[model samples]
Target: MFKNGVFYYYTVLSILFCLLSCNSDSSKPFEDFFNTTVSTEKELGYAVEIEKIALDHIESSSYIGEIGYLKDNIAFVDYRFCWVFLFDYEGNLIDKKIGHGKGPNELFIGRISGFSFLSNGQSLFHEASNRVFVFDNNWKKIKETRINWKGSQKYGKARNIKRPSAKEPIIYSPDFGNLKFKNFNKKCYFPIYSEHSNFNGLMGGYKYYKEGRILAELDLSNYSDINILRLLGRRTPELLNYSYLPHHSTFNFDIDSKGFFYIAHEIDSLIYVYDHDFNIKYAFGVEGENMDTNYKELKKHDVKKFRELFFNDRPKRGYYSDIKVFESNDQNLLVFRSYRKSISSAYDGLQIYKNKKLIVDTEVPKGFEVKYYKNGFYYSNGTIEEEEEKISFYKLKLYHSVF
Candidate 1:
């Protein structure tokens, strides 16, 4: 009887210990369990026919800030010169307008920050003036309405705003900053604050997915690993763990039409796709490539300096320039950008992935930023430099058969 009682008491104690351990370690880690490293020795074998179109003739002093698709035959280009241009499918300059003044028709050009295309033929231009300008298909200024979003004292500014419909706007908070809604009957939303860092902003990859699953980037440079926040509508956010592979530098993220999340590295050539549960769905990339290999590993502090470190040449490191996704016919078009150690401002080349598999790595001409649309890719070289003045833009079409 005595021996049996002793055995039962130990079993109860063991159960209680396990419960405590599990509660203490609530967050999940994604290092060895989720690492998807690609080889740096494979060569790219896809053909992309490039064509250049000159938009500089329209406005010599203007440069392309953002490019987007309006319809099957229409494209909208934002010119930091205080105007937006409309182009046809063939890249012909169709119509344009200027909204750079404080008049009724004109807008505070400095306040015009971003734009979003709606299902209707109108586009919404978000401005720092706390208003949005609605432009019709003919480039006519239809109306300008005020928005409810104001910069949060905690979060620096709203990263982006998406209006799914006319009802309410979905505001994306910055990774390192705070986002607070003014008119809404809600408390302050999310704030990025920690003891180590004074100011916080998102590293990148801020997406609002289906059913209120917001994937936010967390800057964990102080710690070894970065964090991913899975936030619901009003409930507390669940923190997920992520680690950087040795060769991988920046981890940018994107989501497809099917709700699959893609985690792309700036230095490493490989791209990883994760399901809703954050499991590695698929991994693909090329070998002997990716700008990461060209760089020499610098001190860990170099990561904090990012651009400054490269410019000073104290410890040069490769930087991930850009990452975006285009969804079509149930397949995902992934774009990744990488830059050399010396020239961090311009992208070295772009690696295009179709459905998570590498299709091509196109080395764009200098001073061009390549953007993907439903039909094809647009490379704009209008933003900088005297030498870049020659070429305005380039349209590229990829032939998958050559891959």
Candidate 2:
């Protein structure tokens, strides 16, 4: 008699929980956001082939950072050899200068943080020394400017600068986890981040698009809401703003030239497209693919043990790590990386979409980390030798699919 009473009490709680979840307002936003859907039963419409171009001349001891390209076909590769390398279209080293030192004609001390392409033949970089250096197309050092970290902002160093989209001369820097915009005269914090404190998680990836459309991805342990914030404006971000609920797992999203957003959840194979107003445009997924296979395995383990391992060391299961999107004149590309269970390596996949149809579902080669896209190819970095003494940079070519 006592056992029967316990079972009845638990049954009533479960039914109430379901009723509350089904009546939530968050469910409506997801349903109304989608206008169209593409069935994965359709055949893939694109093919891909990678052609590896070897930078054999780069020293084995040098580490390659990110690769930047010029319209004239010049590739500016950041080499940890303490300088930036300039390469021609044929992979031949043209001129490598950007020295490492404290003197004139030399880059600032410490490793090359990153390189930014300024207009014409100019580029900029900020190094570990917290100084910004400017370079020309000829590998010549144009100027070095010291960042003035004043007031309460002196704790974090500014890493990179985002050029302004409007007539304002202000540029933004990822200061630790916060956004700081400055010009030659004064500096200030982005207004939204100033007003909302919790949204300031250590910023992971950010894009400042044209007309003040800002997409910022952060790492926060808050609720299930998607960890992205959309802001519009320069000096103060006070324009169109909206955030969607993740509802399940943490994911990544990117904006295209047309202001459409492409988002993919970590555990599901489905990819969603949303408009600038946060309405779902369409959704598609890979047919017969189980992207959540590892997530299910995680559920079988003890909850306490899983939490211990995740916080103290590392999680015991594989999960989606990142997602990236690239928009070109005729096509859009989506790339996602997943950590494989019981393995140290990750699995990378690239999908291409054209004319509202899925085309490519191919794997990126192991070892190389794809960074950016240009023309019809992608750029990646890896080590050519196992001894950690040498590194190799590659350019990948894409083959259009016929199916």
Candidate 3:
């Protein structure tokens, strides 16, 4: 009898121990579980080299916006010209079709935001019109849906009153007056307007008008917004007010692995991490030169520095062109693109940041583009003065793995 009693007691103790471990404090700060190591092989300035292949015409122009690879060795490319091009793994163009209706000037290439590939060999795409379109493996249009929004009038008037500054390139909408309403592909787009007011005099605020918006779908849906936010920063109410009169606001959101939704604003350069229940986990990045200061303050003191440190130093506009998130070995890798006319002939390059710190600066030759792939990196250089357009793929070599 004593032996049986002891066994029961031990079992109870084990159960209690497990219960205690499972009850983690919900307020704990997010902990990063991955480490990043740089390559040590002489730091080649341009590590990627392109191999020329016969160019086959898929679309009228080769200005590809988004690209995705499927399980069956099929690749999808989104041409900003309102078309989706499907290719094989070997970069051979297989099929192409227009994304919009047939009209000489009716299809605006700028309206298409992103394209996504599903496990079922279908593709999903979003447009500025606030609509999401689904296509099959053969690039055939399947169905289209529009996101619903309430209180759009109030949001619209708020946007037009404040617009984005001229110096800053508008990431989302170029025209504030004709803002689209809907949440296609889980995307929310809001318009910014310029307004003259006391609280945000000469400055603008981004009204929370829309949600469930998709900008790009290279990786899992959960990683999209977080990837872009890490590249840009945050949009402030004051800054939104400066966008344009009766401006609108759009939110592109995706839930991360830990049930946190990563949100990014089109006009602002900030990224916000929120729990599944809509509670904010943390916010990263700031506008202009003050980003460094805000980052340092946030690190030194676990206090929220959203308003004081970042908003105060917001620039009139300018800086940063694109942001993307890439994952390798279960770690989130951020890539930021900055355009500087004063730099080399091709003044675009990828700034690699891990854990909110700038680590390596990989330059993309002039007229070329850089994107992160599953194994390594993909780059495409458009033909310039005497060079022909070319694309290349490379794998990243880590110092730890080599030594």
Q: List the RMSD of every prediction in angstroms.
A: 12.2, 16.3, 12.7
Deviation of model 1 at 185, angstroms: 23
Relative to the true structure, candidate 2 reaches a TM of: 0.52
Q: Candidate 3, after superposition: displacement of residue 331 in Å?
A: 4.8
Q: Pick the TM-score winner.
A: 1
Ranking by lDDT: 2, 1, 3
Runs off by more than 4 Å, candidate 1: 1-45, 60-64, 72-81, 109-111, 118-253, 275-280, 287-307, 310-317, 324-347, 367-369, 373-391, 400-403
lDDT score for residue 225 of model 2: 27
lDDT by residue for model 2 (103-132), tens:
667754656655555434566565545466
* Residue-wise C-alpha lDDT for candidate 1, range 1-403, written one tens digit per residue: 8989999999999999886654321223324224555433333456677777654345533444555655554444443555666676566777766557776555665644555454455555655544556666665677665533222321232222222211112233332211211111111112212111211111222111111222333222212222222332210111112121222222455555555555544454456666644555566656323344444333333345544433454224444444566656655464554334334534456666655556676566553445445455644433333345432556667665542
Write the residue-wise lDDT of candidate 3 on 53-128 in tens digits.
Answer: 2333453544555444555333434445675555554667776665555543223435576555654566566566
Model 3 residue runs over 4 Å out of place are 1-55, 59-82, 97-114, 118-121, 127-130, 152-256, 259-272, 276-279, 283-318, 330-345, 366-372, 377-403
Q: Each candidate's TM vs. the true structure?
A: 0.55, 0.52, 0.47
- lDDT of the structure predicted as candidate 3: 0.39
